[model samples]
Target: MSAASERAAAAEGEQLARTLAVLRETSDRPLSFVTAGAFAALDEGGSEPLAADAESGTVIPANGLVLLYGDGGAGKTTLVLDMLVHLASGEPWLELVMPARPLRICLVENEGPRQLFRKKLARKLAKWPRAAETIRVLEEPWQGVSFRDEAQRDEFVEFVTAQKIDLLVAAPIARLGMQGGGTLDEVAEFADLVADVQRRAPGLAAMLVHHPNRAGQVSGAWEGFPDTTMHVQASGHGRTRILWQKLRWSSLLHGKTTHLLWADGESFTVDEREAVTASTMVDEILAAVLESPGASWTKLRPRVRGNETEKAAVRDRLIADGLLVNQTAREGQFRLWHADDPAATRSELRTGLERLPFPTPEREAAAVPVPPFQRSIGTVERERHGRPGSLVADCLICDHPFSVDDGSPAMRCRACVALTADLVTEREADQMRLLERLRVREALRGAA
Candidate 1:
């Protein structure tokens, strides 16, 4: 036989072998596609929650993809390591619970040097030595292989299955050598590949660490790809905010933002003190409007406690929910009022009230005593802040209500006060170290 014919026959045999292998592997599995009604009727048990926080609910689903993306230096890698340690140790990660038994994890480090990765793993293991047993690192040679290729995908599935990995962690999707610049089509194709791999290895979950685009948004069609998508951003003072951007299957954590403090290089803790809830912001807005009826946007906005964006969002939500009325009071000025107030429904200002103005000194002095609404606003603000006069005051830091003497000047609770002092000392120490480093560098330069 000619050499060309022999080569052709060999290629044909290889393709046939691959086809048979797939068939044999899936022979016991059910059909892939089904009608909507049929899928709903399937007796397959509900998916169990893998990693969850008792207070915050499920984070990583038992058998789905989780996308954690952030800008560079936002501690994405560190946070992932923290999560892996918790999963492997069966401990809660930033209060997110893990299964009772340690989960087998496969960390596919594609973005950094193996030696550097080793140092990170070592630091985490120093705290929880036993977790090292369940955590596995993928071989360096296969790190850069693209999952888009069918053969490579099959090999990866085989590796995970052999290791009995329950969770897979892939760092920085860019290093995976996937084609395209994270456009919708490109991301969808990559997502399809992940689904295929998950199908082949049932009960396996994946966490993909990715970098955001120039706009600081997750690049590509990420909205539909992952079961949960978290956006991490630095919130200053060594705090990172993990916003639950998308929760497709569960509403437990929808629109909730959790804050984590970098306690050390190896782990993070949930900083409940700094974490503000949606309800708190809503109360603040309502109180502000009730305090000053027909308060203009400018006057009302600053009273609501939060960043400008959060305040605006909550205020808009109140307007949408019909709890607050935003009406034009005068040219170029809009007024906000409680929806239940009579003034909020008025088309025009009271006819004679604006005209009867400019009272004499005696009349001004005799003006009606402070109205109930006026007093209520002050009381509400004082109560919220836990002012000296209030019997119980909200902690200035965590907003926890604590007992206080009638005239005591204490603003923060005892716990918050101590935490603040420690944080201040830590900052001062860091500054001193920085100064010492600068002095040493200067002395060395002079000597040189």
Candidate 2:
């Protein structure tokens, strides 16, 4: 045979071998055979473990599943957007270094109307001109994505494959028809589906956004299935941070507990000013402590800055860092002394405290709007729900009687309290004045 024919025959044989190998790998086999193969592989020392290849350092692993979760409104969306910026600009994230080459990314969001998402995304990509070129967005609502159905999933999988998507972000798992509970098996099925997506598109990494439960944990067993788990939180004001991180493959991940200020919607930078402020706070705290050694928090409280939150945070950091110590033995005296010098303690603040009291919080959650009935309490009439007059309760101020109903509690009777935020108490000033005048006249008559 000619040399060219021999080469063609060799290529055909190689293709056939590959096809047979794939079939063998996919076919179910006896447990004993699998165990024997595993043992044989273990006995063979020549093979090496797979080398790690990250899409963006360890922040988003290549060809792996990651779940970025937080409470609602915790800036999970912001963090992911920032990540996209890094991918586009080849910029380093808080600690996650970007690869030299730019990655193609897609964000499938379901929480909002597309125009609003477009507006927000436009702001994020303002600085990076190249971002628009590589990032594909789907402002599709969660209800529209029937990922539970195989047909919908396959269509998406095909889209992912066609796009050659390096990183795919599907936010808010709740939106993707995976909203909360079914069974553990159902959760596992969802996880399997996510894995199958990766399998369908080799070298495709996914970052899923999810919300945490009341206990501050992800909703299901799917949490453990992700290759990496990032918990995002809004620390205070515009500041945000990664509350914690769990990385299975590489601890090369950054910012497990670093505060990040949103540079914009699309990016982040370390809250460096916060560090400076904290340092200043520590110095102020130290000076205050030195001025009156063993001074209670109450004593030094007056010296701290206007933001008591910063003050409390700095105090906690001091104690946590071993720069300060609480040495007050008596109750209600939260006195502080130098960690290095217990002997430098000063006298406690108060003469006596009933308990170790913390300052009452001045700030409150935004007040709930009072119902219209409560707003116009005097107008209309209160109807008794009970039989004729089973029992009656009188308004504390007006003495207006209304039948007490078991269905509603005393506190629920907003009409009586008129518990609107703007409500003012009315007093019988005229009656008091007349009584005072009468007493004065009587006294004058007696004296005369």
Measured against the true structure, the TM-scores of the candidates, in listed sequence, are 0.61, 0.54
Top candidate on lDDT is: 1
Model 1 clashing residue pairs (backbone) = 52-97, 386-393
Model 2, backbone clash pairs (residues 3+ apart or across chains), number: 2
Candidate 2 structure, TM-score to reference: 0.54
Q: Write model 2 residue lDDT over 1-448, tens digit each, in one string.
A: 9999997688557646754875698786745546766877675421221122233335456677778888777788777887776776555556554444577787788776677778888887787778888888864444377455556667778888898777888877876756348357777756666766677777778888887777877777664677778888878877787754677755555324667876644567876543436778888898887778667788897886536887888887776666776654443345576655645332254222111222111211122232111111122222442222122333344444333333222222223232211122234433433454453343334334
Instruction: Give lDDT tens digits, candidate 1, residues 1-448.
Output: 9999997688557646765877798797977887999988877742666676565456677678999999888888888888888888887666555464588898888866778888878888988887888888877575565665567779879988999888988877887755578778778767766777888888888999888888889977678778889899888868888888887655767667788888866578888764455788898888988899867678887776677787788877887677887654233344677877765653334321111122232432344343111101112223444542323444555555444433333455545443332333445644544554453343334334
- Global Cα RMSD, each model: 20.3, 18.1
Quote model 1's TM-score: 0.61
Error of 2 at 252 (Å): 4.7
